[model samples]
Target chain A: MTIGLYAPGASALHRLPAGVKLGALVAASLALFAIPSTIVALAAVPVAFAVYLSTGLGLNRLILELRGPALLLCFVFVFHALAGSVEEGIAAVARFAALILLASAVTLTTPVSEMAALVERLLGPLEPLGVNPAKVGLAIALAIRFVPMIAEEYRQIREAQAARGLDRNLLALVVPLIIRTLKAADDLADAIEARGIET
Target chain B: MTRDVSTRDIVYIALFAALMAAVNLVPPIQVAFLPVPITAATLAVMLAGCLIGAKRGGLAILLFVLLVALGLPLLAGGRGGLSVFFGPTAGFILSWPVGAYVTGWLTEKNWPRMNAVWFFIFSVIGGIGVVYLIGIPWLALVAKLSLFDAAKGSLIFVPGDLVKAIAAAAIAETVRRAYPLMQAAR
Candidate 1:
């Protein structure tokens, strides 16, 4: 199963090299803060949405991406309004919201594998520093692989806790979760060892 | 314990990193008017350190952070990517690996006499003290709020974090008695 936010499309955004898009993202983020004009910062939000929309992702998809940060954006506005720095608040919110939109755009358009490859390549230069880029990439893939398993374990443990009278106790919930996480890790380790995938 | 990261160590790191992602799916407690909600994901940071040794624990969290930056919706409330780096709580988010590292380092140092109290103390020191050390200043700078103002909003997370520290401490002691995962790495 496809585990991430990647939504396939043939749009220019989708066809754009993952590394270039990521580089643009990093550059744009730096520029957002480096520029002092709040208006310029706020203006970038629409541009980000435009890029997002160009991916054939639609306005609804773009708006949905904003839902999580929307609350925070509102709070940011209100906090700054109270502090008598509404313009500053708007700038901060705008910068973050735009970045969020752009990020989602990148993730949705780019396949996880492509992104992983980009990361590995980016880390390649650090190999001399003893950073094993391939291992790091594999670890990331393995971590993603483990997510569904861990979520299942979390659910089972929560259910088990509820079955007893210990549902409300934090320790009851936490202790077994930790134990099971370790157990799962141990089993996976033994499997990897048996497979002789040299570290 | 050898300097080389064995296959077991890699799996442990990956699993804990996965644990971070999975924990983010837990329902977050939204404090009205507060941008960042209280989350179990942060508790997982403590668990990463308290369960795994320093090196792997820290690396586990570092791995998670890299994935988050890579645009995975691995954070609570489904927030991730470069967007989070620009957000007000970016400081706290970035501090996860450091916090985990400190917690694990302290845990390792006190392993011989490990108990709930030591676990709690280390978790608090690393998870709370170290995290907010970076998080608060970042919040203030990014949000253009005064230190006092930034802290006022951030203090809300403290009560919940303390509770998580307690849970981590309890789990730490229980794991030590029942199954010490860190021992294998050592």
Candidate 2:
């Protein structure tokens, strides 16, 4: 809910190692794409939904999770319908939707920290390739942590612009938003340095 | 041009990536004429490139994309997960890092001479042109359309993207004058 699909459940999926879950998602996606049958893809949709339900995240959260994909699925169907046969279009949409559902279920059960740890460990072998997985993981954590705060700032900026009747003025809105964000970053840097984190 | 990345650089990278995600809070405006809705997230991508430099800017976007792939709804319209990589929107999302890198490269190379006009030019070139170059073909393939048709359909994004470019330029200029990190990479 913060910035990830994690639902903080105690399901078997939640207990699985992050790497294994990710690997399984990738394998499942490949398998879905490898199959060419429309009926098979459509039939798999229920199985995908079952995976989500198995996590015990509740129907409401599942619905919320599916909202974005649902809209996009409609768009995909419409485009494919116009360009090709409706049957094929449905197949394409079904395949994509099932894959998304399964992947989302994995994420819904896995924590971000676990994923980061898995990534860092996985990239350990790539140290010879000049890849600093620790730094990358830290960057990812910070990005995830800061996204919600910055989104609140964005919402405030938009509301302020709309209040001033300059909401339509893209420059007016963007300039202030950038200025504020830069200032906040500067302050954050100073705070970090003061805490002796790094220079 | 290569210096050890400091704590500040790390924070900046994270913050810019956060900014990229944050812009999605500003709901996409749907112009009835366009198939693709206009979102401020792309503007933030350009800002990340122009305000930060090539390496950090590109890394920031790469970070964002990675999160999206991990099933974070960081994209506009709350879209996320692995399926996004296989959809029509895949091209633009995949192009983000390269697009940011190109924009940052052009901006930093021309830092001394970079004015609002130059910022606008670079943003247009990297943000729109580069993104479209790859995005159109991918869209064509995914949607089962000809390249020309894909290009034509993309025209609807032009006016809005141009506006975003101008806005990004104005902001980038202000950040340069105030924060002056434009020359950090050099």
Q: Which candidate ranks first by lDDT, i.e. highest?
A: 1
Error of 2 at B160 (Å): 2.8
lDDT of 1 by residue, B1-186 (tens): 123777788888888888778767655434332345535566777878888978898899988987777667777757666567766678998898899989999988878888999999999988999999999988888777788877888898798788778877877888789886657768
Candidate 1: segments with Cα more than 4 A from true spot: A165-168, B1-3, B26-39
Using Cα atoms with residue i matched to residue i, what is each candidate's TM-score against the true structure?
0.89, 0.82
Clash pairs of candidate 2?
Answer: none
Writing each residue's lDDT as its tens digit, candidate 1 over A1-199 gives 2556677789998999999998898898889888978999889989988887888877776666677778767766777888998888888888888887887788788877788789899988887777787688778888888888887777777678779966555667657776788888889888888999976
Q: i-RMS, every candidate?
A: 4.1, 4.3
- Each predicted complex: what DockQ? 0.47, 0.45
lDDT of 1 at B55: 87
What lDDT score is found at residue B178 in candidate 2?
71
lDDT of each: 0.79, 0.75
Error of 1 at B10 (Å): 0.8
